[model samples]
Target: MTPTERPAGIVVVLAFAGITASLMQTLVVPLLGDLPRLLDTSASNATWVVTATLLAGSVATTVIGRLGDLYGKRRMLLVCSVPLVAGSVVCALAGSLVTMIVGRALQGIGMGIVPLGISALRDLLPPERLGSAIALISSSLGIGGALGLPLAAVVAENSSWRALFWGAAVLSAVVALLVWLLVPPTSPGAVGKFDFVGAGILGVGLICLLLAVSKGADWGWTSGTTLGLGAAAVVVLPAWGCWELRTRYPLVDMRVTARPQVLVTNIASIALGLSMYAQALILPQLLQLPGSTGHGLDQSMLEMGLWMAPAGIVMMLLSPVGARLSDARGPKVTLVVGSLVLALGYGSSVVLLGSPWTVMLVSAVCAMGVGLAYGAMPALIMAGVPETDTAAANSFNTLMRSIGTSVSAAMVGVVLSQMTVERGGVLVPSEGAFRTGMLIGCGLALVAAAVAAAIPVRSARRTSDHGVAAAERSAASVS
Candidate 1:
């Protein structure tokens, strides 16, 4: 059947693909404590399971998005599924740390599916149906993450940890088959020589920067390795930018990316990403900590995840509402409102840490903001860029969010590690530290709101209308 004939099938298939890819983000969370024992490795070495995925995903998201714009997005979508399935299988059979990290890195390479799926919506769906479909796919990242934790916790507690990877393998294989059978092929969005040099340079720079951000706390923030990687990122990223600007066929169109609308939206995205993650880090710790700390809820991992799972459901349910808000008031206003809601969620955490119910309430509110913001970001980005650049622009925006989350993890780690209370001779994070983390999230959310509010409203509307008209023309020609 033609893409237009089955748009709903395409959306559901792609959204499922996105959710399957994002599940990698939290799949290993439940096993983090047992990884060293399971793999017979040191604690630090075991961490590479998580860090490898982050580094791989960060690099692969942009590169794959660019590839999708050059080749058929459907082709790239299938290609992405290969590694996701393979990685899950590898991880399932992994008996050592090296094998597990290798599998995780492969899984991360598939992270581009979310952006690719979002871009595909623009290609396949009518403009009227675009907003809500994009909203659902974009928010799938949070949906998968919030839901994966509880499911993983349950499996890890009852069965072999390998069962988690085996399940992932099956889910990924199903997503791949669905995409192949259900999602129609789209025309390549751009024609250009693939920028191998830019991809490599950007990969190197990102690896350096993310490695430092994610590992700094464990590696000693002042250590030579951390400092050196940080220095390399500082130098390498600028060089990569210069190369991109000079290249005839750039991996990322720096000129388009420098537009006021796109730039401001990206800036706001970073802050929103940071704010979104800060709560994810702090609240689970608060929930799992012993109640003796005066602020802890003393919940099991499964219980904590169950409490948080509602937030994911809330995000899923709110997608269409956010779409209506964007349709009525513009994506800029939606973004601003979402950021404010996020700030409100964090701010309320200051006074609501007394019980799991209050904590769940805070999480649901924050998820609502994230749902609105995530839904609007792509609309804002796609509005600013030509249709040809949709996937690349969205991928870059996704990268910005990744950077924000990395920074948040590092910053929150420092705060929680330093301000610890002695609980049975163990240095657990104190109540004050959790509060401070929430305040930090709150402040960043406000910053996001302010930045989003500054997006050039008139220019964005003009560009968006022009983009839509051009896309319609292109589709007519294709048909």
Candidate 2:
């Protein structure tokens, strides 16, 4: 590929890869109720099907990103796809809960593709085109989550559940082929010794932290197991941080990460993730709960998914607009706009709870905010870090969002569990409880807006200079 050649094929391929990776997050949501029966396992065991993926994805994303920085983004991308393809096939043939958990863990490894794809945009796309390309790719995270639910619900309702896995397998294979053909090879990565020690330390800490967050409700938050893991993380993570600072070629460069611009953007990312996921958690249930409950929409799973699917489309449509905004007003301004929109969406939910259409409208508004925020986040991080640290920094930012979502799930679970109404001998979250969750989401979004407002304007100029330098290096390598 020449410097003058456009990267249309590259952007599409990378975006498709991102969508493929994110689809794994929601692929099994439709199967949750049926999982115990399908695998002949207890409900607690079935939950691991979800938890395992979360843990694996959290760890794999960080680890694979550092590896991509050391090896090559395109190479690691292909490496990541192998697991996705194999995991989907294994899942298609899975006969037990254990097999399903293993396969899901493998699928989680593929989540690295999203950040790798974003970092690759920094490498291959021109400075002028980079903003929109990055926005579209980043927005795919929300797009896949939004679309996957309805798509999965339809497949599960109409066919053997196994067909879902088979379809994912085919898609993963296709993505691998497309990436190989469309994505051009870049220069060799930073030559440094692989930090196995740092990787192990970080992996253990994240696994412990995430497991406790995702399962603390089921396991009893203060139980010995949860407490022990929590305690271990508190100790392990700080130690991991100390080590990163001391090491010569750390997996993540703590100095760059600690910069005011980078640190503040990451902090805002967590809040944004919490705000975005809270709506996702609450709306579907409100739409699907028994209408007899008076507060519920009395819709089926497929109906709920269909209602929610439009939000994904709205994110995709709004992403390019966000890119233009970033170009005109700077990413920090775009991020603030996104955060305020997100808060407005949540505030609207307080009134929109009466009907399905209103709920969808609120969801679409939130998606629009999410599309803008997600697009700007990577641009901010890329601006603050050197080109060599691009993948690692983006991956860390991605991890912060996952952490926020995990915390949201735990906090929302606590609220819904505490404030429940009896319905047909089963307890469900009350209308007030859902409203409270939305309020919390609104508050988080406002916090994000405040944090984004604080990022220095000087960071944008710094990033532009770095981008030009990086592009020059890329062109020289290609020649």
Candidate 3:
């Protein structure tokens, strides 16, 4: 059926694809402690299983998003599924750390599905139906991450850990089938020779920057390896900017991205990403820490995940509400409100960390803000960019969030590692560390609100009107 005839089906399939791709982010979390034993590798080597996925996903999201715009979003969506399925199968069969890391990296390449699917919504859905669909798909990253933890924990507790990857393989295969059947093909949005040089340079720069941020704590913040990667990123990224501006066809259009509306929205996105991830890092440990620490709730991984799963549900339920707020008051207002709510959530955590129930309340409140902010971000991005650049632009915005979360992980790690209490001769994060992390999140969320408030209202309205007109025209053509 044509997209116009089955827009709901298209949205459902694409959102499912997005959720499946995001599931990879937390699929192995339940096995993190067991990884060293499972792969018969050192603890440090086992960490590569997680780091490889983060690095691979960060690079692939932008590249694949551009590819989707250059080719067909539907075609690229299908292409993305292939690696997800293959990676899951490989991970299921992996008996070594290298093999598992390779599989995880391959799965990370599929992370483009979310943004690609979001860009596709602009092409396939009526403008009226667009906001809610985009919101749902955009929030699927958190939704999957939230829900995957409990699901993975359960499987890890009851069955062989390989079953987790095996299940992922089946789910990915299903997503591929559903997309092939339900998603309508879209014409290439932009025409140009792919910028191989720009992609390579940006990839190197991102790897350097993200590697430094993600591994800095483990490598020692001032260690030569960390400092060298940080220095390389500092040098390489600006060079990449110069190359992008000078190249005939750039991987990312620097000129367009520098617009005040897009620029500010991306800045807010980074802060929101950092704020959103801080809670994710802090709360689980807070819940799972032993009761002897005075602040620990003493929950098992499964129990902790179940308590946190409500946050995912809150994000899902709030997607349409956020869309309506955007429809009524504008996406900017929605973004601002979301940021404030995020800050409030974190602020409450200062007093709420004493119990699992209270901690869940904090996570749910933050998830509400994340749902609102995440939905509005792409709307602001798509409004600022031309229809032809939607996929690449959205991908870049997603990359900004990834960067924020990476930094968040590093910063929180530093705090938790340093502010520790001795428990049974082992150092565990002190209560002060958890409170400090939440306060940092609270500060970043306020910063996000300020940045979102700074987005030019006039430019946003003008570009949004143009984007809506373009979408209506595209829908009309399809009909």
> What is the C-alpha lDDT profile of model 2 across 273-370, one tens digit per residue?
88789999999999998899989999899999999999999999998998888877778888999999999999998789899999999999999999
TM-scores for every candidate against the unseen true structure: 0.97, 0.96, 0.97
Query: Which residue pairs of candidate 3 clash?
Result: none
Model 1 is weakest, by summed lDDT over 10 consecutive residues, at 458-467
lDDT of 3 by residue, 340-444 (tens): 999999999878888999999999999999999999898888877777788999999999999999999999999999999999999999999999999999999
Worst 10 residues of 3 by lDDT: 458-467
Off by over 4 Å in 2: 459-479
RMSD per candidate (Å) reads: 2.5, 2.8, 2.7
What lDDT is reached at residue 360 by model 2? Answer: 97
Worst 10 residues of 2 by lDDT: 459-468
Cα lDDT of candidate 1 equals 0.90
Number of residue pairs clashing in candidate 3, backbone atoms closer than 3 angstroms, sequence gap of 3 or more or interchain? 0
Question: By TM-score, is 2 or 3 better?
Answer: 3
